[model samples]
Target chain A: MSILKIDGVSKRYANHTALDNVSFSIPAGCIFGLLGPNGAGKTSLIRIITQITGADEGEIYFRGERLKPDHIKEMGYLPEERGLYKKMKVGEQLLYLAQLKGLSKAEATARIKTWIDRFEIREWLGKNIEDLSKGMQQKVQFIATVLHEPSLIILDEPFSGFDPINANLIKDEILRLRDNGATIIFSTHRMESVEELCDHISLINRSKKVLDGPVREIKDAYKTDTFQIIGNGHLMITSPDFEVLEQHENHGVFRANVRILNQAKPNDLLRYLIDRVEVHSFVELVPSINDIFIRKVKETHHA
Target chain B: MRKIWLIIQREYLTRVRKKSFIIMTLLTPLLLAAFMILPGLLMTMSGDEETVMVLDESGLFEGKLEDKKDLKFVPIAGSLEQAKTLYQETDYTALLYIPKISIEDPKGITVYGKKNTSLQTQMRLENALEKEIENQRFMASGLDRETLDKIEANVKLNTINLSSEGEKDNNAMITSAAGVVAAIIIYFFIFLYGVQIMRGVIEEKTNRIVEVIISSVKPFQLMMGKIIGIAAVGLTQFLLWIVLSFVAVTAVSAAFGIDAAPTPMEQLEAGRVAAEGKSVDVINEEKGEATQAEADEFANTIQDVTQSFANLPLLLILGCFLFYFLGGYLLYGSLFGAIGAAVDNETDTQQFMMPITIPLVISFIMSYSVVLKNPDGPVAFWMSIIPFTSPIVMMVRVPFGVPAWELLLSMALLVLGFIFTTWLAARIYRVGILMYGKKINYKELSKWLFYRV
Candidate 1:
C-alpha cells in the first residue's frame, strides 16, 4: 500500500520553477530514496511533501486521503540544513520538538529517554546544543526527528555530518525503523547509500523525475549484456557477434571482459567466450547505482 | 493550534530563563528608582552655603535684601573700587555694586564675582532691588507703604474645567507631565518589545530552524506565537518594574524619614508652593507678623493642587495604557517580524525598518511637543485619531481628558490597524521565511505579499 502519493505537484518561486509536475509515491514500510543532484528540485519536492511550502498545482495524498494539516503530526522531517536552538538544552529542545509533533509531554519524555539511551547520549541531555560536537548534534537532531515515532519519516542528507561508525549506527536504526512498519523517504546525492539501504527510489533532475523504480528493477533495467570471464586461454579470433572490451593476464591466467552485441543474450556470450578460453569463471557485470545515477542525470541533462 | 501553543511556550520559557532576561528584568527598576531619587538626594547632601557682598553706595538697598539659609548677603560700605578689591579678597560668591544712580534708572548696578552668578541668584537680586526702588518711589510720592503693599498683591487664579457634568479643578502642568510620561512608557515598550520580536524571528531564520518548526505549524502561527510570547515577556518585565520601583521608592522615602514619595505632579506642585512660601515670608517680615488666614489659604492651595490628581481618570488611564501598549506592540511587532523574515541579516533590515520606525519616532516627538502643549488642538486630535500615531499620541491626550467618542474611535481604529498589519505581515512572512540568499527589496516584498499561500 502506498503511504504517500504526490500527483503532478508543482511549485514555482517568483523567478524560478522549483518543482514542475513532480509525481512519486512511497509504499508502506519501504525505504524510498529521493535522488537528485544539486538544483534538481529534490529539496523543493521534499519541502512540498513536508508542507513547509504549498504546492502551486496538483495534490498530495497521505494514506489514500488528501493531505491536511493534521497529517503533519504523522510525518517527521529532518531537513538538510540541520538546526536546533543553540542555547536550549538537548533534552528540553527534543521534548519541545516532540510535543510540537503532537506527542504528550509524558510520551515525549519517555520516548526521548529511550532514544537517548539507545544512542548512548544520556549524559549530553542537560547540555546546550552549542556545546555539542557536530556529530553529536546530528545524533540529537536524528533523535528529535524520530522521537514521536512518526509513521513516515523524511531525512534529507541525514548522514552528511556523521563519521563512518555513527553513519552505520544511524543506518542500522533506519533499517530497524523500516522493519517495524515505519515508511522512510531519505533524499541525498549519495547513491552508494541508496544501493545499500533504499528499496525504491525516484531520481529527479531539473524539476522532473528521470528515473524511478525498485532498486533491483532499476539495476536490471540499466543492465547491459556484458560478461566478465577469467580463464587460462585467450581467443585469437574476433567475431562481430561479441566485442572484447578488455583483456588482461591475472594470476598466470587470461581474464577478458566482453560486451555482447545486438540482441545477444548473456548465455550466448558466455558460450562464445567459453569456446575460446578455458572457462574457469563466468559472471555478468551489473552497473552500480552510482554509475546509473550519473548516467541517468547526464542523459536527462542532454535531452 | 496546539503546536502554536507549544511554540509559544518554548519561546516564552527559553527567553524567560535566559540570564540576560533575568538580569535586565531585575535591574531596570533599580535604575529607574535611582534616576527618580538621586538628583534630589544629591541636592540635599550638598549643603555648602553661599555668601554675597552688597555694596550700597546710595544706601537705598540698606536692609532691603534679606539673607536666607543657603544665601547670605552682607552690607559693605565702600567705594566702587574698594568693593571690587574687597570682593576678590573675601569669600563672597558674588559682589553686588549699587552705583549711586537715581531710582528712575537703576540699570547701572553691576554684579561682580570670580565666575558668573547663577540665573536664579541674578533674578533674586534683581527682584529685591526692583521692590526696594518701588517702595522708595511710593513713599516719596506720599502713598502709604501699607496701601502699596496691598495694591501689589499677587493674584492666584485657580483654573477649573466646566462641563455638563460639573466644574472640576484642572492642573494643566500635572496633566501634561502625566500624559507625556504615559506616552513615553508606551513608546519605550512598543519599540523595545517590538525589536525583541524581530530579533527572535531573525534568530530562528538564521539558525535555519524555521523550516523544521514550520513544518508542524504555519508561518503565520509561528509569527503570532513569537510576537505574543515576547509581548508576554515585555508585560512581565513591565509589571516587575512597576512593583519593584514602588517598593524601592517607599523604602528609600521611609529610610530618609520622609513622607511617601510624591508623584511627579505632587512634586511640581510642591515646588510652586515653596516658591510662594518665600514671598509669604517676605510679606510677614514687612508686617512683623504672619496672618493665620493667609497661611491657611496657602495651605489650602497646596491641598487643592495635590488633590487635582484624584479628579484624573487614573483607572481609565491605566486601562488605556495597557490596551495601547499591546495594540502598538502588535502593530509594530508584525512589521518588524516581516522585516526580519525578508532580510538575511540585521544590516539588510535598515531599509525595511525605516517605514515602520518613522511613524513611531514621529509619534514620540509629537507626544512631547504638540500633544503635551495643546491636548485639544487639531493636530493632537488628528494624531490621536490616526492609527499609526494614536497609541502614543492618544495616551498623551488621555490624562488631559479626551472626549469619549474620540477615545473610542482611536481604540477601534487601533484594533483595525493591528489586524491589518498582521494580515499584511503574515503574507510576506509566509513566503520570505522560506526564501534564502535573495537580496529582497520593497518590490520583492510586495510581490511576496501577493503570492498564493
Candidate 2:
C-alpha cells in the first residue's frame, strides 16, 4: 500500500507553474527518491505532501486515509536549506522541535538524549548552534528531524553539505530508518545517491513527471541492448549478427562494446567471443540513474 | 492551541531570560530613585555654611552686609593683608575687599579665597552687594525701601475653566503636560516593542527555522504567539519598573522620612488651592522671602501635584492608558511582524515601514503639536476617532476632558482596527515567511494577501 498518494497535484505561483498536474505515490516501507533538477518542482511536490503548502488541485492520502494536519506528527521533514536557532542551545532546540512535532517534553528529552548519544554529540548539547561547526549543526538538525521517530521522513538534499565521512554516516542512517519501517522520500538532483539507496523513484522535470518506477525497472527501460567485453586483444569481428559498436586497443588489451542483433543470443555472443580471444568478462551495460535523469530532462526540454 | 501556547512560552522565556532584559528591568528603578533624591544630594554637597570675611575700608558700608542661605559675612576692621591671613587661617570660602569708592563709580572689589569658591556662593555675594548699593543710592535719591517695594507689581495669572458643572480651577500647564506625556509614552512603546516583534520575525526567517516552525504549527499561530509573547515581555518589564520603583520609593521615603514628589496628575489640586484667590499674599512674593522658604516650596510643590491629580479623572485616564497601551502594541506589532516576514533583513524593511509607521508618527507629532493646543477642535476630534492615530491622539485628548460618546466610539473603532490589521498581517506572514531571497514589493505582498491559503 502507498504511504502517500498524490493525485492530480498542481501548484502555481504568480510567475510560473511550480507543479503541473503531477501524480505519484510513495509506497510504504520503501526508499522513494524524488528526483529532479533544480527548479523542476521537486520541492513543490514535497511541500504539498508535507502540508507546508496546499495543492491548487489535488488529493493526498496517507496510510489509506486522506492526509490532514494530524498526519504532521507522523511525518518528519529536513528541508533543503538546513537551519536552527543560532542562539538556542542544541539540546533546547532539539526538544523544542520534538515538542512541535507533538512529542511530550519527557518523551522528547529521552529521544533527544538517545540521538545525541548515538551521534556522539553529547558535548554539543549545551553549546549554542552558532558556536558549533557546520557539520555538527547538521548532526543536531538530523537528530531534531528524527527525534519523534516519524513513520514517513522527507529529506531534501540531505547530503548537500556533508563531507564524505558524514555523508556515509547519514547514508547509513537513511537506510537504517527505512529498514525500521519508515518510508523515506529522499529528494535530490544527486543521482548517485538515488541509484544506491532508492528502490522506487519518480523523476520530475519542467513541472511534470517524466519518469516513475522501481530503480532497476527504469534502468532496464533505458538499456541500449549493448554489452561491454574486456579481453586480451581487440576483436576484429566481421559477422553481421553481432555489430561492433566501438573497440579500443589499449597496450595489447582489447575493450569492445557490441550490440546483439536479431537471431543472436547473449550465450551465442559469449561463445563467439571465447572462440576469438581469451574471455575476461562479459556484462550487459545498464544505464545509470544519472544518465536516465539527464536523458529524460533533455527529452522533455526538447519536446 | 497547545502548540501556540508552547510557542508563546518559548518566545517569552527566551526573551525574559536575556541579560539585557534583566539589566534594564533593574536599572530603571534605581535611576528613578536616584533622580528623586538628586536635589537633596545637591544641597548636601556643602552641608555646612561657609563664612566670608569682608575687609571694609569703605566705612560707609560698615555693618550692613547680611547673611544669605549657606553664606555668612563677617566684617573685619583690618587691612586686606590681615583679612587674607584670616581667610588662610580659617575655612573661609572667600574674602571680599571693597575700596573707598563712591557709589556712582563702584570698582576695585576683589574676592580672596583659600580655594576657588562655588559659583552659587559668588553669585549670591554679588547679588547682595548690588542690592545694597541700589538701596543706598535710592535712599540718597530720597526714596525709602518700603515705597520701592510697593512699586513692584506682581502678576500671577490663574486660569479657571468654566464648565456645566461650575467654574473650577483648571491647570492648563498640568493637563497639557499630562497629554504630552501620554502621547510620548505611547509613541515610544509602540516603536520600542513594535521593532522587537519585527526583529523576531526577521530572526526566524533569516535563521531558516521559520520553515520548520510553520510546518509544525500554522503561520498564524506562530505570528500570534510571537506577538503575544513580546507583548507579555513588554508588560513584564513595565510592571517590574512600576512595582520596583514603588517599592524602592516607599522604602526610601520611610527610611529617610522624606515625602515623595507629586506626580503630574496630582499637581492639579495644588494648583487649585495655591493659585485661586490668593492675591492678598502677593506682597510676600519677593526675592528675599523666596530664598527663605526653599524647603517649604518643595513641600508646597508636592501638595500642588497631589491636588491636581485629585482633580483629574484618575481612574479613567489609567484605564484608558492600559487599554491603548495594549491596543496600540497589538495593532502595530502585527504589522511589524508582517514586515519582518516580507524582508530578508532589516535594511529591506524601509519600504514597508513607511506606510505602517506614518500614521503613528503623524499622530504622535499632532497629539502634542495640534491636538493639545486645540483639544476640542476638528483635527483633535478626527484624529482621536481614527484608530491608527487614536491611541496617541485620544490619549492626548482624554486628559483635556473628552466627551463620553466620543471616547466610546474611538475605543470601539480601535478594537476593530486592531482585529483587522492582525488578520491582514497573518495573511502576509504565512506566505512571506516561506519565501527566500525574493525581492518582495507591495504588489507581491498584495498577491500573497489574495492567495487562496
Candidate 3:
C-alpha cells in the first residue's frame, strides 16, 4: 500500500505555475528518485510532500490519512538550504532538533551517540558548529534529520557537499533506511545515483511531471527498435522506411547506429543487417534511465 | 511547561556563567561609591587657605574684622587706590575694600576685591562688616558689651518623631535612605535584565537557532522563559551586590578607624554638637567667661532644629520604594522583550525601541511631581497606579508619606499591567520570529497580532 500520496497537486507563484496537476505516490519502502533539471518543480513537489510549504491545490495523505500539522512529527525533512545553529555545540544541537521531532532526551541521546559513532563525529560533539567544516556540519544536520526515525524521510540534495567516500557513506545509509521500512524521497540532479539506487523515478519539467514509473518499466517503455552493430560495413539506407543515423569506425571495426521504421522489430532489422555486413556483433540498444529522461524532457519541450 | 522550564534554565545558566555578568555585578558598587565619596576626598586633600588684605578708609570701624583660620584678614595701612595697586605688585591674594558705613543704614557699605574673589571669601567679608556694624550699634546704645556677648549663644534644634507605638527616630535620614535605595534598585534591575533580553534574542537570531526553537515551542514560551530567567538572574545579582556592598563598606570603615564610624544620624548629631562646642570655646577664651543664660539659649536652638528632622514619617518612604521598583521593571521589561522580537538584526531594533523608551525617560524626569503634590493626592495616585509611570513616581513619593490603600492599589495595578503587556508582546514575538527580510511597522505588527493561530 502507498504510505504517502500527492493527488493532483498544483502550485502557482503569482503568474508562474510552479507545479501543474502533479499526482504521485510512494509505496511502503523504496528509494524514490525525483529527477529534474533546474527549475523543474522537483523542489516544489519535495516541499509539498514534506509539508514545508502548502500546495495551492490538492491534498497529501500520510499513512493513508489526510495530512495535518501533527503529521509532520513523523516526517523528517532536510531542506536544500543548510540550517543549523552555528554557535551551538554539535551534540546539543542534534539532540535539541531530535526532541523537536518528538524524541525523549534519553532516546535522543542514544540515537545521537549511535549516529555520531557511525559517522566518527564523537570527537566533534562538544565543539561549536562554526568550528566544523561545511561537510562536518552537513553530517551533523543529516544525523539530526534522521535521528528521530521518522516514517517518511525527504532528503533534498543530500550529497551535494560531500567527498566521494562520505557521499557513498550517506548513500549506504539511505539504502539502509529504505531497507529498514522507511519511505525515502531522494531529490537530486545526479542521474548516476538514480541508476544505482532508485526503485521508482519521477521526472518533472517546467512545473509538470513529464514521466514517472518504476525505473525498469520507464526505461523499457522508451526503448526504441534501434541496433548497435559493430562490424566491418555499414548498411545503406536505400529503403524509404529505414535509415542510418550515423556511422563511425572504431579500431578497425565499423560501428553503425540506426533507427528502424514502424512495424519493424529489432530481429528483422538484424536479419537485414547480417546479409550486408560481417555480423561481428548486433545488439538492440535499451535506453538508460538518463537517456529516457533527457529524451522525454526534450520531447515535452518540443511538444 | 517542562519545555519552558528547560528554556529558562538554559538562558539563566548561559548568562550567569558569563564573565561579563560577574564583572558588572562587582564593578557597579565600586563606581557608585566613587561618585558619592570622591569629591569629599579631593577637597580634604587640597586644604588650601585664602589671604585677604582689609582696607577700611573711614576709621569709624577700625579693628572690626577678626582673622579666621581658613581666611587670614590683614588690616592694611593704605588708601584704596594704593592698596589696589600694591596687590598687583605684591602677592596679596585678594584686596577687600570696605568703605566706612553709616551706623543708621548698613547697606551703604561697599566691598571691593580685585579680579572677582570667590563667593566663600565675599560672604566672609560681608558677614564681618555686618558684625562690626552691630558691635558699633551696641556700644552706642549704652549696652554692656561684655554682658551682651555673654548672653549671645547659638542654639541648635533636635527632632524626635514619635509614632503611634511611641517609637522615636529621625525621619529625614530614613526617607533619604529609602529614596536612594528605591531609585537605585529600579535603575539597576531594569537595565540589567532589559539588556539580557536583547542579548538573548540576538544570540538566537544570529546563530539561526530560533528557527528550530520556534518550530516546536510557542514564541510566547520562549520569550517568557527568557524574560523571567533574566529577571531571576538580575534578582540574584542584586542580592549578591547588596551583600558585597555591605561587606565592602564594613571592611573599608574598619580599615580607617572603626571607632570614628557612627550611624549616619549620629554623625549628623555629632556635627551639630561639635559646631556648638567650638563656638562656645572660642567665646569663652576671648571674653574670659560666659553666663548661664547664654548656654541655655544655645541648647534650645539645637533641640528645635533636630526635632524637625526626627519627626519626619519614614515608613511611608520605604513602602513607596518597594512599589515603584517592581512596577517600573515590569513596565520596561515587557517593552524590552517586544523590541527583542520585532527585529531580525540588532541595527533594526533601534527604530522600534524609541516609542517604548521615551515614556520611561519622561516618567523619570517628572518624578518630582509626586513630591510636590500630596503623596496620596489624585495626581500622585494616578501616576503611581499607571504602569508606565509608577516606578519613578512611587520613589518620589517615599520622602512624603502615602496612604496605605493607594500604595496597595498601585502595586496591584502595576502587576496587572505587566501581565497584559507580556501577553501582547508574546503575540508580536510569534509572528516576528518566522518573519525575515522585510522591515516590520505598526501596520504589519497589527496584522501579525490579528493573524489566525
Candidate 4:
C-alpha cells in the first residue's frame, strides 16, 4: 500500500514553472528514490509533499486521506540544505525539533537520549552546533529528522557531505528504519546508492515523470534482451532469432554477446547457442540504473 | 499554536541567556545614572576657593569691594606693578587694577589672571563693579537707596491654564522635560529592540535554520514568535532599567548630598512667596507686622504646588506608555522582520529600512521642537494621532495631559496599524523566507506579498 500519493501536483514561481502535472506514489515500508537532474522539480515536489508550500493545482494524499496541517506530524523532512541552530546546544536543539514535530517533552527527551546513544554522539550533546564538524552536524540533523519516528521520512541528498564510513552508517540506519515499517523517500544524484538501497524509484526530467516503478521492474523494462555467453563457441550463422552484437576469441575460449529478436525467451536463445557451440557459461546482462537514468533523461530531453 | 509557543520559548530563552543581553541589561542603568548625576557631583567637588588683590588707585572706589563665596578681594597698598608682583608672590588668583583716570569709563579696569578665569567668576567680578558704579551714580543723582532697590526688584509671572473643568497651574518646565524623557525612552526602546528582531530574523535566515523550523510551523507563526519574544526582552530590559536607574539615581543623589537642595518647583514657589511677602510687608508697615498671614500664605503656595504634581495623570501616562511601547514595537518589529527575510544580508537591507524608519526619525526630531514647544498645537495633535509617529509623539504629549478622546483615537489607530503591518509583513515573510540567492528588489518583494502560499 502506498503511504503517500501525490496526484497531478503542480507548482509555479513568478517567472518559472517549478513542478508540472507531477504524479507519483511511495509504497509503505519501502525505500523510494526520487531521481532527477538539477532543477528538474524534485525539490518542488518534495516541498509539496511536506506542505512547505501548497500545490498550485493538485492534491496530495497522506495515508488515504487528503494532506492537512495535522499530517505534518506524521512526516519527517530533512531538506537538502541541512540546518540547525548553530548557537544552540545539540541536545537542546534536537529536543526542540522533536517537540516541534509533536513529541511530548518527556518523550522527546527519552527519544533524543536513545538516538544520541545509538549514534554514539553523547559527547556532542553539550556542545553548540557551530563547534561540531560538518559530518558530525549532518549526523545530528539526521537524528533530528528521525527522532520523531514518523511513518514516512523524506531525505533530500541525505549523504552529500558524509564520508564513506558515515555514509554506510546512514545507509544502514535507513534500511533499519525501512525494515521497522517506515517508508522513506530520498532524492539523490547518486545512482549507485539508489541501485543498492532503493526498492522503487520515479525518474523525473524537466518537471515531468519519465520513468517509474520498482527497481527490478524499471531495469527489466529498459533492458534490450541481450545475453552474454562464455564458451568454446563461434556462432557464424545468421538467423532471425538472434543477432551477434559483439564476439571475441581469446586463447581457447570464444566470447560473444548476442541480442535476441522476435521476442525469444532466454531458454530458446540458450538452446540455439548450445547447438552452435559447447556452452560453458550463459548469462543475461541487464542495464545499471545509472545507464537507465541517463538514457531516459536524455530521451526525454531530446523529445 | 503549540508550535508557535515552542518557537517563542526557544527564541526568548536563547536570547535572554546570551551574555550580551545580560551585560547590556546591567550596564545601561549605570550609564544613564552617570549621565544624569556625575557632572553635578564633579562640579560641587571642585570647590572654587581663590583670592584676588585689588589696586584701587582711583581712590573713589576705596572700601567698595565685597567678599563672596569661594572668592575674596584684598586692597593692595601699592602701584599696579606692585600688585602684579604681589599676585605672583602670593597664592592670589588674579590682580584687579582700577586706574585712577578710569572712574568715568570703567573699561580700563582690567583683571590680570595667571590663566583665563572661569566665565562664572569673571561675570561675578563684573557684576559687583557694575553694581558699585551704579550705586555711586544713584547717590550722585540724589536718588534714595530704597527707590533704586525697588526699581531693581524682579517681576515673576505665575501662569495658570484655565479650562472649562477648572483652573490648572501649568508648570511648563516640568511638563516639557517629562514629555521629552518619555519620548526618548520610547524611541530608544523601539529602535534598539526593533533592530534586535531584524537581526534575529537574519540570523535564522542566514543560518538556514528557518527552513527546518517552518516545516513544523507556519512562517507567520515563526515571525510572530520571534517578534513577540524580542518584545518581551525589550520590556524586560526597559522595566529593569527603570527600576535600576531609579535606585542608581537615588543612591548617587544621596551620595553627592544633592537631595537636600530644593526641587525646581519648590524654588519657583519660594520665589513667589518671597515676592508676595515683600509686597505684604510694604503694605503692613503702618500696621506693624503680618508674619502670621505671610507664613500661612507661603504654606498654602507649597501645598498648591504639591497638589498640582498630584493632579498630574501619571497613571495614564504610564499605561499609555506601555500600550504604545508594545504596539509600536509590534508594528515596527514585523516590518523589520520582513526586511530581514527579503534580503540575503545586512547590506541589502538599507533600501528597505529607510521607509520604515523615516517616520520614527521624524517623530523623534519633532518631539523635541514641535511637541515640546506646543503640546496642544495642531502639529503635535495630529502627529500624536498618526500611528507611525504616535508612539513617540503621543508620548511627548502624554505628560502634558492629552484629552481622552485623542488618546483613545491614537490607540485605536495604533492597534489597527499593528494589525495591518503584521498582515502585510507576514505575507512577504512567508514567501521571502524560503527565497534565496536572488537579488530581491522592491518589485520582487511586492510580488512575494501576492505569491500563493
Candidate 5:
C-alpha cells in the first residue's frame, strides 16, 4: 500500500508554475527517490508533502486519508539546506526538534539519548552545535530527522556533505529504518546514490514528472540491448543481427560496446562477438541512472 | 499552541540567557540614574574661591561690588595701568578694570583674567555696578528704596480644568512635560523591541533554521512566537529598569541630600492643611521676608506638583501606556519581522525599513510638537485616532485629558491595525524566509505577500 499518494498537485509562484500536474505515490516502507535537478519543483513538492505549503490544485493523501496538520506528526523532513541553532546545545536542539514533531519531552529525551549513544556522540550532548564538525552536525541533523520515529521520514540530500564512510553509515541507517517499517522519501539529483539506494523514483524536470517507476524497471525500460565485449582479437564483423556502437583498439586487443537490434538477444550478441573477435568477457550493459537522467532531461530540454 | 510555546521558550531563553541581555538589564537603570544625577551635582558643587583686584579708573565708585560665596574683591591701591602692569604679581582671579567713563554711558567695563573669569563672576560685577548706579539715581530723585521694591509685582497663573472629575487642577507645563516624557518612553520601547523581533527573524533566516522550525509549526505561529517572545524580553527589561531606576534615583538623591519628588504621599496630607491657609502665600508674595517668601514659594511648588500628580488619572494613563506600548510594538513588530524575512541580511533592509521608521519618527515628532502643543486640536485628534501615530500621539494627549470616546476609538483601531499588519506580514514572511539570494525590493516583497504558501 502507498503511504503517500500525491494526485495532480500543482503549485504556482508569483511568476512561474512550480509544480504542474505532478502526481506520484510513495510505497509504504520503502526508500522513494524524489529525483530532480535544481529548480525542478522537487523542493516545492516536498514542501507540499511536508505541509509547509499547500498545493494550488490537488489533493494529497497520507495513508489513504486526506493530508492534514495532524499528519505532520508522522512526517519528518530534513531539508537539503538544513541547519541547527548554532548556539544551542546538541542534546537540547535534538530534544526541541523531537518535541516539535509531537514527541513528549520524556519520550524525546529517551530517544535522543539512544541515538546519541548509538552514534557514540555522548560527549557532544552539552556542547553547542557550532563546536561540532560539519560531519557531526550532519549526523545531528539526521538524528533530528528521525528522533520522533516518524513513519514517513523525508531526507533531502541526506549524504551531501558526508565523507564516503559517513555516507555509508547514513545509507545503512536509512536501510535499517526501511527495514523497521518506516518510509523514507530521499530527494536528490545524485543519480549514483539513487542507483545505490532508491527502490522507487519519480523524475521531475521543468516542474513536470518525466519519469516514474521502480529503479530496476526504469533501467530495464531504458535498456538499449547494449553489451560490452572485451577480447584479445581485433577484427570485428558487422552484421544485421548486431551493431558495434563503438570499438576501441588497444595493444593486441579490442574492447567494444554493441547493441542488438531486431529480435536478437544478449546470447546472440555473445555468439556473434565470439565469431568476430575472440570474446574474453561478455557482459550486458544496463543503463546507469546517470545516463538515463541526462538523456531524459536532454530530451525534455530539446522538446 | 504547544508548538508556539516551544518556539517562544527557545526564542526567549536563548535571548535572556545572553551575556549582553544580562549586562544591559542590570546596568541600564544605574546608567540612567547616573546621567540624571551627574549634571545636577556638577552644577551645584561650588568651585574654588577667587578674589578679584579692582582698578577703578573711572573713580565713580569703589568697594561697592559685593563679594559672593566663591568670589571676593580687593581694592588695589594703584592706577589702572599700574594694576595691569602688576597683574601677574597678584594672586587674583581677574582684574576688574573699570576705566574712566560716564556713569550714564557705561561701556568697556572689562574683567580681564589669565583665564577668563566664569559667567557668574561677570554677572555679579554687573549687578553690583547697576545697583550702585540705581541707588545713586534713586537718591538723586528722592524715591524711597522700600517703595521701589514694593512696586515690583509677581504674578502666577493657575489653570483649573473642569473635567468629569470636577475642578481638577491642571498644570499645563507639568502635564505636557509628563505627557511628552511618556510618549518618548512608548516610542523608545516600541522601536527597541521591534528591532529585536526583526533581528531575531533575520537570525533564524540567515542561520537557515527557519525552514526546520516552520516544518513543525505554522509560519504565523513562528512569527508570533518570536514577536511575543521578544516583547516579553522587552517587558522584562523595562520593568526591571523601572524598579531599579526608582531605587537608584532614590538612593543617589538621598545620598546627595536632594528631594527627588518630595514624598508626594506625606505632602498630600500636608497639602490639605496648607490649603486652609491660602492667604499667607499671597501675603508673602506681596511684602513678606524675601527668604521666607522664597522658601514658602518653593514649598508650595513641591506641594503643587504632588497635588497635580494626585489629581491626575494615573491609573488610566498607565493602563493606556501599557496598551499603546504593546499595541505599537505589535503593529510595528510584524512589519519589522517582514522586513527581516524579505532580505537576506540586515544591510539589505534599508528600503523596507523606511516605511516602518518614517511613521514612527513622524509620530514621535508630532507628539512632541503638535500633540503637546494642543492636545485637543484637530491635528491631535486625528493623530491620536490613527493607529500608526496613536501610540505616541495619544500618550501625549492622555495626560492633557483625552476624551474617553477618542481614547477607546484610538485603542480599537490600534488593535485592528495590529491584527491586519500581522496578517499581512505573515503572508510575506512565509514566502520570504524560504527565499534566498534574491535581490528583493518592495515589488518583490509585494509579490511575496500574495504567494499562496
Candidate 6:
C-alpha cells in the first residue's frame, strides 16, 4: 500500500504556478526519488506534503487518512535553507529540537549521544554551534532532524555540502534507514544518487510531473538499440538486419558501433560482425539515468 | 503548554546566562550612584584653595562677609581699572565687580566676574554686601545685640503631616517624592524591557532562526514566550538592582562615616516640613538656640516620611507596578513581535517600529511633568486609565497615593488592553513570520491583522 498519496496538488504564487496538478505516491518502506533540475516543482511538492505550504488545488493523504497538522509529528523534514542557533550549544540545541519533535529529554539525550558518538563529534558538545565547521553543523542538523525516529523522512538536497566520504556515509545511512522500514522522499538533481538509491523515481519539469515509474523501467523505456562490437581489426559490415553506425580503431584492436534493425536481436548483430572479422565481445550500451533525465527534460521543453 | 514553557525557559536561561546580562546587572547601580553623587564628591575633593580679588564699586557696603577656613577674602586696595590690571597680573580665581546699589532700588545690585570664576564665589560676595547693610541698620537702631540675635534665629512657622489619611494632607513633598519614584520605576521597566523584546525579536528574525523555531511552535506562542521570558529576566535583574543598590549605598556610606539609611520618621519629618513652605536648610543645621518646647512642637507637627515608604499602600503599589509592567510590556511587546515577524531584517523593522515606540516615549514624557503634577487629576487620571499610557502613567500615579478604585480600574484596563493587543498581534505574527521578499508597511500590517487564519 502507498504510504503517502498526493492527488492533483497545485500551488500558485501570484502570476507563477509553483506546482500545477502535481500528483504522485510513495510505496511503503522504499526510497522514492523526486528528481528535477533547478526551478522545477520538487520543492513545492515537498512543502505541500510537509504542510509547510498549503496547496491551492488538491488533497494529500498519509496512510490513507487525510493529512492534518498533527500528522507532521510522524514526518521529519530537513529543509534546504539549513540553520541552527549560533549562540546555543550544539548538545542543548539538538536536545531542544528533538524534544520539540516529541521525544522526551532522556530519550533525546540518549539518541543524541549515540549520534554524536557516531559522528565522532563528542568533544563539540560543549562548544557553541557557531564554532563548528559548516560540514559538522550540517551533520548536527541532520542528526537533530532524524533523532525523533519519524516514520517518514523528507530530505531536500541532504548531501549538498558533504565531502565524498561524508556523502557516502549519509547515502549509506539513508539506505539503512529505508531498509529499517522508514519511507523517505529523496529530492535532488543528482541522478547518480537517484540511480543507486531509488526504487521508484518521479521527474518533474516546469511545475508538472513529466515522467515517473520504477527507476529501471523508465531507463529501459527510453533506451535506444545501440551496441558496440569489439573485434581483432577494423571491419565494415553492411547488412539489412544490422547497421554499423561507426568504426574506430584503438591501438591494435578495432571497435565497431552498430544499431540493430527492427525485431533484430543482439545475437543477430553479433553473428553479422562475427562473419566479417574475429569478434571479441558485443556489448549493448544502455543509457544511464542521467542521460535519460536530460533527454526527457529536453524533450519536454521542446514539446 | 509544555512547548511554550520550553521556549520560555530557553529564552530566560540563554539570555540571563549571558555575560552581558550579568555585567549590566552589576554596572547599573554603580553608574546611578556616580551620576547622583559625583558632583558633590568632586567639589569636596577640590580642597577649596582658590584666591579671589574683590573690587566692590557698587559696594552698598563692605567688610560684611565672614571669613571661613576654605575661602580667604582679599579686599584689594585699587580702582576698578587697577583691579583689572591686578587681576590679570595675579592668578586670581576671579575679580568680583558688585555694581552700585541705590537705596531706592534694592534689586539693582549686579556682580561681574571672569568666566572661570565659580558661581559659589559670586554668591558669597552678594551675601557679604547684603549682610553688611543689614548689620549697619540694626546697630543704628536702638536694638541690643541680644535682641538682634534672637530675631536672627527666628524661623518661619511651618507645620507638616506625613499621613495622607488626614483631611488636611499638607505634605506635598512626600507626594512629589512618591510621584518621582513611581514615574522612575515605570520608565525603567517599560523601556528597559520593551526594547529588550524588540531587540530579541529582531535578532531572531534577522538570523532567520525563527524559521526553524516557528516550524515547531505557533508564532504567537513563540512571541508570548519570548516576551514573557525577557520580562522575567528584567524583573530578576530589577530585584537584584534594588538589593545591590541598597547594599552598596549602605556600604559606601558606612565606609565614609555617614548614616547610610535615614530613619523613616526623620525623612517623613523632613519631607512634611519642607512641604509646609519651610527651607530644609533649617533642618540641616546641627545647632540652634530655639526653645526646647518650640522644637518639640515643630517635631510633633510633621508626620514621618518613613510612613510613606512603609505605610505605602503595599498591595496597591505592588498591584499597580505588576499590572502596568506586564500590561505595558505585553501590549507593546505584541507590536514589537509583529514588527519582528513582519520584517525580514532589522533595517526593515525601523519602519514598523516607530509607530509602536512613539506611545511608549510619550507615556514616559507625560509621567515626568503632567502626571507627577496631579496623578489623580483629569489629565493623569485619563492618561493612566488609557491602555497605552497606563503602564507608565499609572505607575507614576501610584507613588502620589492614588485612590484604590482608580488603581483597580487602571489594572483592569491594562489587562484588557493586553488581551486585545495580543489577539491582534497573533494574527499578524502568523502571516509575517512566513512572509519574505516584500517590505511590509502599516497598511499591510493592518491588513494582516484582519486576515483569517
Q: Once superposed on the true structure, which residue ranges of model 3 sit more than 4 Å away at CA?
A: A2-26, A32-75, A95-107, A160-165, A186-303, B30-192, B255-342, B368-424
DockQ of 4: 0.71
- List each candidate's DockQ score: 0.67, 0.57, 0.21, 0.71, 0.66, 0.34
The local lDDT score (0 to 100) that residue B197 gets in candidate 4 is 79
Which is superior by lDDT, 3 or 4? Answer: 4
Candidate 6 residues B198-299, lDDT tens each? 677767765556656665666777888988898889889988898877666655545553332333434575667756756545544421323344544454
lDDT: worst 10-residue window of model 3 chain B: B282-291
Candidate 3 lDDT, B85-147, residue by residue in tens: 877776655777767667876554545555666676677677777767777888889776677
lDDT (Cα atoms) of all candidates against the true structure: 0.84, 0.84, 0.71, 0.83, 0.85, 0.75
Chain B: TM-scores of all predictions? 0.73, 0.84, 0.66, 0.80, 0.80, 0.71
Per-residue accuracy of model 1 over B6-76 as CA lDDT, tens digit each: 87787788889899999998788778777767765664454257788998887778897777666689898
> What is the TM-score (0 to 1) of candidate 5?
0.84
Scored against the true structure, residue B2 in model 2 reaches a CA lDDT of 92
lDDT of 6 by residue, A1-303 (tens): 999998998888655887889888889898989988887888778877776557888899999999987877788887776778889999999998887777799999999999988889899999998898888888888887788887899888888888888888888888888889999888988878667888988888789888888887887798788898777965866678777778888886898778888889888877676777887888888888778878987887798
